[model samples]
Target: MGDPHPKIEARAVTRVFGRAARAVHALGPVDLTVAPGEFTCVVGPSGCGKSTLLRIAAGLLRPSSGELRIRTNARRPAAMIFQDYGIHDWKTVLANIRFGLDVQKVPRREADARAAHWLDRMGLTDFAAAYPAALSGGMRQRVAIARALAVEPEILLMDEPFAALDAQLRTILQDELLGLTQTTRTTTLFITHSLEEAIVLGDRVLVMSARPGRVIAERRPPFPRPRTGAVRATPEFAALTSELWELLRGEVGAGAAA
Candidate 1:
């Protein structure tokens, strides 16, 4: 069983862009938590501050009101993988993977060893010398994952990291991620628009409303872990997906109507 204490916690967190009359209430009064070693996914209508909440968790953005608590002894605390891959064009695949380890001041030889391990794991060993320009979309995303994992972050935050890939590639990476997270037991918070993806990847799926996003519903799939594409074929999977969509449909429609 995972720790009862929250690895990540938010209390009435909110965000607003600009001031007064022009102020755009982007998120919250949202409250949520992720237990240690848990994989939690968030789904919401477009422009619903899913990314804003993620940014707050990543400490890249501060909430306008309320608080976020991330409990980790590690210096970096978290590693984030973005949809854009976020690797440097100037660095080789190997360098990109080592970048975070280096920042942690992991020794040179240790960093190289750790980077090499992830390169092999991500199947990027062949492209170790190549820059981001040389890799395919899926390959680039793998590199991004490798870089994030190499740091051994206490919490992993992903913002639709596989969303841009084709369906086939997305499934492949999803399984790979499931396997890695299961093995490492890294706490993760993922954001996606796909209810199927959220159901497939998360231990619990959180649904958010349209703009000024607030988590309005949550669902936990009954299927057991080491989950893969095989789970999608089960009736239970379909039922859960339908259930989450029912909760989301109105919010999505409202966002569209707005």
Candidate 2:
């Protein structure tokens, strides 16, 4: 049979900030496709427009050229998690998780049930009434993640959601995320600077050049599916991480100079 249609497709996508001589060419002429149930990660230098590419996919920013297409029948087609933990302080943990459902006008009872389910799954059940200020950075991030997952989005765009956490906590959440996404088979696009993270979490890892970023290399982890943190212990994982770093090392210097 023919290949199934892409869940997310971008063709010659580009983004520019400002205009005239002040124009900052932030991203693309990039082309990429994410198939249904795929987890893709992007790794690049600091100024490489990694986040710009994600924001464009999220429909939060308009690209200067090219096109982005998302094909999914999900009531909420996409949900995004940011590094800063996008949960609202004004909303309690339960309410924060239910926010999207509320916006979609889901029945109040159903929304509450769904939110509560995710709260328990994320280990936030006891903190249902707590505000963002009352939680630690890790817990607040969990609330943000629970809120996104409660909506059951077809596409999950995560921009270094675990980047700020301590190493132990980051691994804990990474393993949790691996299990969740594998079970749901959600199409995910994760952007991170950590090569090990990209390898551990992504089926396919794409490397980008500096500044005006473009895909420089694409590598798929040879590891099997339903992966956990143990995959990082294998020799292949180390080699692949080293390979990606070499591809990115020069770009890092270039981005710094730019």
For all candidates in order, the CA lDDT equals 0.93, 0.93
Give candidate 1's whole-model lDDT. Answer: 0.93
Q: Tens digit of lDDT per residue, candidate 1, span 3-116?
A: 679999999999999999999999988999999999999999999999999999998999999999999888888999999999999999999999999888999999999999
Q: What is the lDDT of residue 20 in candidate 1?
A: 90
Q: Summing lDDT over every window of 10 consecutive residues in candidate 1, give the lowest-scoring window.
A: 221-230
Flag regions of model 1 displaced more than 4 Å: none
lDDT of 1 at 214: 97
Q: Kindly report which residue stretches of model 2 are placed more than 4 angstroms away from their true locations once superposed.
A: 1-3
Per candidate, the number of residue pairs that clash is 0, 0
